[model samples]
Target: MKEVRLPTIPEIVIILGAFLALVFSFTLFLDLPIQLALFISWFFVIILGVRLGHSYQDLQKSIMDGITNGLEAVLILVSVGALIGTWIAGGVVPTLIYYGLEFIHPSIFLLATLIICSIMSIATGTSWGTVGTAGIAMIAIGEGLGMPLPLVAGAVLSGAYFGDKLSPLSDSTVLASSLSKVDILRHVRAMMVLSIPAFVITAILFTLTGFVYGGRNIDTEKVEFFKTSLQQYFDIGILMLIPAVIVVVLLALKKPSMPVIVIGALLGAIWASVFQGIDFADAINIAYKGFAIDTGVAFMDGILNRGGIVGMLDTLVVIIFGLGFGGLLEKLGVLKVIIATFEKKLTSAGNVTLSTLIVAFLGNVLGCAMYVSLILTPKIMEDSYDRLRLDRRILSRNTEVGGTLTSGMVPWSDNGIYMAGILGISTFSYLPFMWLSFVALGLALIYGYTGKFIWYVDENSPSDETEYKGEKVANDY
Candidate 1:
């Protein structure tokens, strides 16, 4: 097979034009609100997509394909929005917040936040869900306890990403495994070598920080106020468990995501009406406009009073634009050019591993989405790994470490932007405490260079497994 070449001048112009349009849309933030900014960004993306190819018809076709590829993700986000809205209305989120306050002490709140989010994200296979729900509450608790906002945001992000890296249900994880033809469970288990260490070190840092900042008195009044308001608005019963249970059961049964999420949204609406004294019209409104709270406690309100379809629209728009940007790059063959450049330089196991890390990082930085990073990196690096006789597990782990871990560190990236916004901290503020991501990257590089944890197939004594399972083209060089 011949090497894929870089895009010509015209292709570069199209790519640059799309990027500039994205920047222009973001500039709307200076004048308009966040929601409006999102709308503008997506509109720019659509226009850019239409102009990227040969003719208007071709551009329209590309736009349609981009939308089709993103359709499932869009539905999932909408469902997630409804789930959050109803969960708030049904008092599930509030109950979690109320109970979380009771159990978590200020001294170890950071570490506790990490653990709780990690568990929840792993269970749901969604870092975003974990962050939007428990993560927001934890940030509130941290503020009430007098912890620095940046540190708290960092802790929440660290835990949430850990789950995202390993969860079989995660879209990025599934993409990486599927693209490489590796077993999902096997890929997850193999990732623990790097992921576990990063998590442990992160926990230790958070624990030590807790001890350093111990004995600060939290505002119990705020906690009480949230609990009261939640009780006032909703029945607050175990029946709230129905929607959550349905999501879990359906996911466990390996059902397609769209139906499962839609059902979950319906259940959320049903529960909101049954328990929250919400009329059908009001419930529908909340599902779209989101529930509002003026708990009078600033931090608690920031945590508790967020949900609805409208609230999720910003994220949805970002996802669509990012995916569309990636699609255009793919169609123009820019990614293939970038990959070929790396293939020429990667000769040893160490180089292959390092290149994989760099590719994953660059993908996230340029592509601005974890799913895009995961999809492109492995495809680019597969040939390099084969030349070094490396196992696919190594590529899988590298992609997770770089793609999943570093995503929250990039300010313009979805996770980082959301975390910074929710925690009321600047992206730069929490960057230092994103210890897990940095540690994971460093560990991957070290292991690759030292061959301490690197796995490879023996070239001299190989049996019948000469061809790598997912290697589409033999590396003739």
Candidate 2:
């Protein structure tokens, strides 16, 4: 076995800079596809790995490792694609949109969208699922209500991630807790210190923003057009929501997402067959190729014509290529070298927490895999936290604040691309309205600097109580 060579800071910078430049040049200025940019980046990283004295086979293994790590996410994306297609065909989504337009007042539409998505995400413990299902319907409803699509997308994303961050059933939450060696409940409690305040602020903002559309009289013509177009095609009723309810209930029971989503897709197909009058074969085909509509209403067609396994192909390519690039960086020790530079700056509690956040943010941006950031940042910073006599729960919370919260804002990230694709809004367009994440970042820094929620660990006493600043504090973990 050839010994792997570790990259120096300067070498890592060159590699990262080149990759970023290529990505920006291709996707931004050149109007080229992101997948092609990522593919080229992957090749560039492999070459750099070889230059660092690693064998081609070793680089290949690293790329495969990165790709394998994200296969579950890829599968979820595929399932979501199928679910969207079938749900649209089954009349579930159209029904939701129709009802949303009828009952949800334009003044409170954005706020309603936020709350509805938050509840759905909390129940299912999957933000992607929430976005793919309820988020789609909300987007259409926003359009019919004459609301800005980007604003609605932002509200939905904020609510989805807020629920996802707090829910114990969430994969990112579980992973962060487990990686930090903190009990899940303890981790959740720790997270609330930052999450709650941010969520409250976000809700308030959404509520205020809702009035901008609410004050204006809703375009009854647009609403009637969408409703009439939808009713003309298929049966839109409350019962169509059965498949969605079942999926939510099953997922809430802690069933694995993959099989549950598949079942949801199947149920949608069944609903389409029995309720919407679509043939079983055609429904399945819709799941594979997506639903098609020629309602003569261009806006309606744009909203309804989406989904299918095929729709996920571009996203899959980006993920695969991004992961491969990230994997090569990981295996070549590039990330470790870069992160070590940040570690040296953790001289105090505030700095420690802040540095952890920075590392996690960098991981999300550079690694492209959300899970990688959640895992790697904490793993690398664990010893630092221990050395600082800080509780691991703090470490976990900051890691999530930096990773999961920020993942959807980065254009090339797994969460970012998935969300942009599903919600039909550009990441940049909705990014400013991702209020929870932005607020949480500021709150975390304040908490760290003010020592408000920073808990200290005493190795001398393993008990759940410690004396700090002349007061006995409960360890809480």
State each candidate's clash count. Answer: 0, 1
Tens-digit per-residue lDDT, 117-143, candidate 2: 899888888898789889999999888
Model 2, residue 324: distance off in Å is 2.2
Task: Compute the lDDT of residue 12 as modeled in candidate 2.
Answer: 81
Flag regions of model 1 displaced more than 4 Å: 1-5, 8-67, 221-246, 249-258, 420-426, 458-477
- lDDT of prediction 2: 0.84
Best by lDDT: 2
Of candidate 2, the 10-residue stretch with the lowest lDDT total is: 463-472
lDDT tens digits, residue span 1-477, model 1: 234334655655665566555554564455434334433444454454444433445445654565456565567667667667767776667666666666788887888998988887776777777777777777766765667878888888888889878788877778777776566776887788889988998899889998887546566775666567656655766676777777767776667655676576667777778777777677767777777777666665666667777887766666665665555556555656666656677877778778787878766665556666777778777877877778777888888887778777766555665566655677788899888888888888889889867777665534213333533322211
lDDT of each: 0.69, 0.84
Candidate 2 wrong stretches, greater than 4 Å: 1-4, 461-474
Q: Give the TM-score of candidate 1.
A: 0.83
The total of clashing pairs for model 1 equals 0
Candidate 2's error at 209, in angstroms? Answer: 1.4
